[model samples]
Target: MTDRDSVFLRALGDAASRLRPEVHEYVAGPPAGSRSGVGRGVFEIAGSPYRRIAGLLRIVSGPDVALDAYERDVPFEIVNRLAADGSRPRLDAERSFRFRRGPRRFVDTLQVGRIPGTLVNTPGTDGRVELLLECSVTADGNLMMQSRAARVRIGRRRIRLPKLVSVKVTVIDGWSPEHEHRTVDVSVRNPVLGTVLRYRGWFPYEYVPS
Candidate 1:
């Protein structure tokens, strides 16, 4: 691993160390090539682990503008407005996040549902299992959504699902607080993964992986 990779690994290890012991079990390596040219590293926290807590922590300690490319991957501006004015916008619950990063346009919608407050590893019909989460928005407009820290046994089975991942929003509106939300969306293929903004309009986005 290069120096940059070492720093990213250390960050991931440090973040994992701060979580509950059980939550650590579900933590996995950041997907191969998940780290783009602009990001320092990409890390993945399983949905099982995410449903345990209500906040997300984006480790952005290395390079400046390390997460610039990821802003288009999440729905930050809309969430910030809701948390700031205490006004709940008419969430489509079906509307997906749509944004542009360079020449690419990414879009994905989550199937929202109230998950029962129960712990069980049930197989999903679409091959993607749903997990409950207590999502919390921070004052700075960053989302810190975590999962219930518990051990889930998969019994040697491999599954593919779009897990809720963290995005760091940069432009916090004046009405927003200083704390950022470790926000996550259900889409996982976007090359950008941590950029955050304060508006819904398109902007020139770029990232240089450290």
Candidate 2:
């Protein structure tokens, strides 16, 4: 990774740490159905806290690192525009984003002009999965910021796993200065492993031992 990339990644990491609460607060509001002045519903009362806690964990622990690292490869022009004159840069928009697992692709649209978050998927020994969702934000009256929780899904696998599996992430758009890869120490029981085999520009290939 270039020095520029490193700087961008660090900046993004810092920004993510600060944006956690804003993302959580935005996600905590009631969905479209609950505002009709209907009688107090079980979901309205019981589900509100659950949603709040879940959003908190998600914001606190989600995939901020990877996303920030990816952003480092973006062109300086875009970065400057995104950063503007602010102390921290926010995600202006997420376009052509796709998460891939083998031949399968999970396609989704991440709304524009929102704080970025992180999502880490680790497999467990009992065949379940752990997902750490995190967000970042700046604290009140402080230059520094901290990451907080929006939600945590323990022992839940949204996608089923094969005996032999690997994770592949691709950034179709946007830019950052740093190479988008990291060496992670995964458990022996984990079906997948993260390794760096090759890199170009700002993206790194995470090789999984076959």
Candidate 3:
């Protein structure tokens, strides 16, 4: 696959071959003639550790950016559209979660990072956060991605977040034959609070015609 069509392909480089066939295809974006990859499923557990913290985040990041509810068996849908940012590959992802009060949505665009073999996901508001992601593959053929750095962009100025205040993430994506679906487990944490937001769920995915 061409790097312009897949940011994960460029970020993973040689390791891209290590990903299982299905997983690789998923990360490589949709195939030719397809517009995007779509998935719908229910999260066995999804929520923030503290509602007050979530509310505080909403004030800064936008209301739909953070979920104020803690609930189980929440249904959600995710769409990943692949596109080009000039010469670079970009993935625009939108997620909508079914919360008790209403739908809580999160959107992000991931692009090639400043450094090779890494990615930057800009999520939330215009200047909410830019996450630096480093990826790895597990022996069992799962994908492990971690966020070690982040920054806030305000017009022409960009401010780096200190480790103590920056958010950290651990994500694992794998194929489960027993369940016949793709599985994802994600944990979002902070230095002060452990895992503030987390979710693990399985979903079947398919590419949509362009």
Candidate 4:
């Protein structure tokens, strides 16, 4: 559907208007056949056998809400603005996430709500293990995920685990000379296991017909 005919697109346009103007530059998709750079994520799974199992299940399930948004063809600008800063990855008040990622899948943040509180996931696949996270933004505008109240789901079964795991995602946005300004750093760790996955890079992207 055209952006003008879709209420979802209209709301996204409105929300983007409220954000920092510089963000608009990133919202617009990259040109065709551009070099969407690389990003890295570090994941560690350690603690009890339960923690290990929970982490594994998380990897298998992948990102829930964020993937859904992408499948729905949500605009990149709206999702980028909501996910870029440390705010919860909410699409709107009643909706779950504020923004969506491009088709190239270069996005690092995912929005998976948890009732009154919010749950955001940043999933990374860096050749080795698939790092999955559930976190929130800090007052300092950083992405953070705590292992406390963390859980794993395999189909209908859900397994809740301890709080010994966490992830910190640091994003650095800069003019790439080639693709304006865009860069990000992500790290995930378990006190018992250390660093498991890490990536630092960027992706050049452009929005196609939805």
By TM-score, the best candidate is 3
lDDT of model number 2 = 0.24
* Cα lDDT of model 2 by residue, 71-101, tens digit: 1122211110121224432222111212121
Error of 1 at 8 (Å): 32
- Model 3 TM: 0.92
Ranking by lDDT: 3, 4, 1, 2
lDDT of 4 by residue, 1-210 (tens): 111111112223344343233333443222334222122221121112232354463464443311222122222221332322354222221112222332322333344444323333434332111223333333333333343344445456555544454333333333345554443344444566665433344444343332
Q: Which lDDT values do the candidates have, in the order given?
A: 0.24, 0.24, 0.81, 0.33
Off by over 4 Å in 2: 1-210
lDDT, residue 22, candidate 3:
70
Clashing residue pairs in candidate 3 are none
* lDDT score at residue 91, model 3, on the 0-100 scale: 89
Pick out the ten consecutive residues of candidate 1 with the lowest summed lDDT: 76-85
lDDT (tens digit, per residue) of candidate 1 on 113-174: 23432112211122223232333333443323333321222445533323334232222111
Flag regions of model 3 displaced more than 4 Å: 1-4
Which model is ahead, 3 or 4, in terms of TM-score? 3
Model 1 local distance difference test score: 0.24
lDDT of 3 by residue, 80-199 (tens): 998887888888888888977777887888888888778888877564677899988888877888997878766687788887777898888888878778988988898987787888
Better model by lDDT: candidate 2 vs candidate 4: 4
